[model samples]
Target: MTHGTSQSTSQSPAPTAPGAGAPSGRRPRRNKVPEVTLYFWIIKVLCTTVGETAADLLNEKAGLGLTGVSLLMSALLAVVLVVQFRTGAYRAGVYWTAVALISVVGTLISDNLTDNMGVPLETSTTVFAVVLAVVFTVWYRRERTLSIHHIDTTGREAFYWLAVLFTFALGTAAGDLVSERMDLGYWLSAVLFALAIAAVALAHRTLGLDAVGSFWIAYILTRPLGASIGDYLSQPTGDGGVGLGTVVTSALFLTVILGLVVYLAVTRKDVAPAQEAVRHAD
Candidate 1:
C-alpha cells in the first residue's frame, strides 16, 4: 500500500483561474513536491536516512562540532532553498537537493540540543512539537487551507517548508528519545516506526482520516524510520548496526538521491500540474 498523500482518483486536467498568471498568460502555479507515488516515498525515506548518516559523519568523523556542522548545513540549505524558490516551476534537482540539505540540518538542530546544550530529548521533542503546531496554526490562519495539493502560492510554499523543517527536528528528538531511553535499538525502533506508519495508513484507509492529517502523520513518522535505518547501517556491529560506516552509508544514499533527482528533473515526473489546476478551479 502507498503512504503519504492519497492519490487523487480524478484524471481530468486541473482547472485554471482567470488572471492566475502573468500578463503573458502563463499557466497557474503547481505543487512543488513530487506526486504521491512509490518513487516519492522511496526518495523521501532515502533523503531522511541520508540526513541522519550525513550529519553523524560530519559531526564525528569530519571533526565538525555540532555547532559547526549545523552552521554549515544550514548555509547549504539556504543556498539550495534560494535556488528552489527562484525556479518558476518545480525542478526536481533543485527541490530534492533542498530537501536533502534540510534533512541534515534538521537532524543537526536536535543534536545541538541533546549533545551540546544537554537538553533532554523529551524537552526538545516537546519544543519542536509546539513549534510545528504553531506553524500549522499560523499557516492555516493565513492560507485558509493546509492541503499539500493546493501548494501554489508563495505563502503556502513558505508555510509548507517551515512545517517540513519542524517535522524533521521533532522526528529526530522523538526517535532518539525512544531508541536511547527505551533501549529499543536501531532495528527495533525502525520496525516500530514502520508499524506506526502502517497503522496511520490503515486509519486513513479504513477510518476515514483526513488526507492532510494522514499525510502529515506519515511525513512525521518517516523521520524516525529514516533515522533508525541510518543508525542501524552506520553504527558499529557491537552497537547493533551493520558496521557500514557513516561515510559509506552517507555516500551511498546521497548518490542515489542525486541520481533520482536528476532523473526527475529531466522527466518532470513528479510535477503536480493536475492538482494545481484543480485548486485554481475551486
Candidate 2:
C-alpha cells in the first residue's frame, strides 16, 4: 500500500517579483504530486485504467447513460476536490480520489462527443489537443514556468487540475481513435503508449529534457495506456478482452488506490511544506 516516496527535501531558490531583485536563498515551494518516481507513475496509470472501466461500468453496464454518469461523477469530483483544496496540505486519499473521479469525468466528456453526438474520435482528439496546448501556453505565459515542483498556490492547483482534465480527455480520444478506427487492438495500443512513456523517461534521463516536460509527457501518455488496459480487462472475451467486467476491474483498482491512500495519510508520506519559495532560478 505504499503510495510513493515522501516529499522531496531539496529546496528551490526564490525568484524576485518583476523588475525587482530576487530573494536571497529562500526555499522553493513544493509541488502537488509526489516526485516523479516509479511508484507515482504506477499509481497514475492504475487510476486512469480504473477510470475508464469505472466510467463504462456506470454508463453502460449500470444503465446510467452518458449524461447521467457524467453528472453523478462530476458532482462527486467537485465534492472531493473541495475537500482537497480546503485541506492545508496534501492528503493522498483526497488527492487520488479526486484524480480518479476526474479521470472518469474526462472519459465521459470524450464519450459524449463520440457516442451521444457522433463526433469522430479524430476530431475530438484534435480539439482536445488544441485545448490542452492553449491551456499550457496560457499557463506558462502567466506563471512563467510549468514545473510541477512548485505548486503551492491555489491558482497553480487550478491550472494543474485543468491540464490534467485535458490529458485524460485527449488520451481517451486518441486511444479510442487508434483502437477502434485505426484497427490497432487494445494490447498493441497499450504497448505503443508504454513505449512512448518509456521514450519520455529516456529523454529525461539521457537527453536532459526538463523535469516538467518529461513529467507532463509521461502523464499524458499514461491515460491512453491505462484506458487500453482497462478495455482489455473489462471487455468481453469475444471482443479480445479477458471479460473480467468493468465492475470487478473498477472495484479492484479502487480498493488498491484506497489502501495506498490510507497508508499515505497515516504516514504523511505525500504531505509537503505549506509555504515554500519559488524555484525558477537560473
Candidate 3:
C-alpha cells in the first residue's frame, strides 16, 4: 500500500489524499518488493508454511540438530541476501529465494528462544511483538512511511527485511502458543487465524480502514495462520495434527512455491509498476 492518507470504502465517499511515502509520478530507482496483490499474499503464506515444515524436516529428518540446522540455514540466508542486494532490483528468483530462506531463519530464531533457552511461548510471543512494534515505530519515524509500495531506498529495504524477520519469529511463537498452550489443535488454530484475517479484510473493504494499516496487520496475521496450517499437516494425528509428516508437507509446499515463483518470474505479473502512485480499497 502507498504511504498516504486513505479514502474511505464505506458509505458514499470520503475525501481522499495521496500518500507521501511513495511520491506520485516519481518512479522507484529499484523496486525491491513485489506489488501487494493476491499473488503476493499467496506466496507469502506458502513461504510461511515452508518456514514451519522445512525447519522441522531439516532439524529432524536431515539429522541436523536445532543448532546445526539454525546455523546452516542462517548461512544460506546470508548468502542469498547478499545476492539479492547485489542484483539491485527485485528479481523474482532472488526475492523469493531470500523470502523462503528468511522464513526458515525466522522459525529457527523462535525455536531457539523457546526450545533451547526454555523460554515460554507466551513470553516469546510478547517479546517478539514488542520488538516488532519497536522496529516499525523506528522505521516509520525515520522514513515517514511504512508502505511497501516504494521500498526503493537502501534504508527502507533494510527496515523492510528487519520487519519481516520479526514477523516470522512472532508468528512462530504465537502460533505455537495458541495451538500448544491453549490446546486449540493445529487445525482449529488455522481456522481461527483464517477467520481473523477474513475479519481484517472485511474491515478494510467495508469499514474504511487505512490501506497500509490493513495490509500490514493482515501480513503479520498470515504468518501464524500459515504456520498453523503447516503444523496441522505435518504433525502426527496423535498429537492433534493430521500426520502428513514434515518431509511430505515441506516438499508439497516447496513445490507449489517453486511453481508460483517461476510463473511470476516468467510473467512478471506481480512486479510493481513504475507508476504505483495510488492504493485503493477493495
Top candidate, metric lDDT: 1
Steric clash pairs (candidate 3): 3-19, 4-19
Colliding pairs, model 2: 27-277, 28-277, 29-277
Enumerate clash totals for all models, in the order shown: 1, 3, 2
* Residues 1-282, model 3: lDDT tens digits: 222222212211211244544332323356678876678889999999999899988988668789999999999999988787666567888999999999999999999998899999889999999999999998877666677765666777888899999989998888888777678878888899999988887887778787777777887888889898998899999987889999899999989999999998888777644423322110
Model 1 local distance difference test score: 0.81
| Candidate 1 ranges with C-alpha deviation above 4 Å | 1-28, 273-282
Q: Local distance difference test, per candidate?
A: 0.81, 0.76, 0.80
Which residue runs of candidate 2 sit more than 4 Å off their true CA positions?
Answer: 1-31, 271-282
Q: Weakest 10 consecutive residues, lDDT, candidate 2?
A: 1-10
Candidate 1 colliding pairs: 15-277
lDDT of 2 by residue, 158-242 (tens): 7888999999999899888878766777788899889988888787677766666677777888999999998889889998889
Give me the displacement of residue 104 in model 2, in angstroms: 0.2
Each prediction's TM-score against the native? 0.88, 0.85, 0.86
Please give the RMSD of candidate 1 to the true structure: 4.6
Using TM-score, rank the candidates from best to worst: 1, 3, 2
Which candidate achieves the best TM-score against the true structure? 1
TM-score of candidate 3 on Cα atoms, chains taken together:
0.86
The predicted structure with the larger lDDT, 1 or 3, is 1
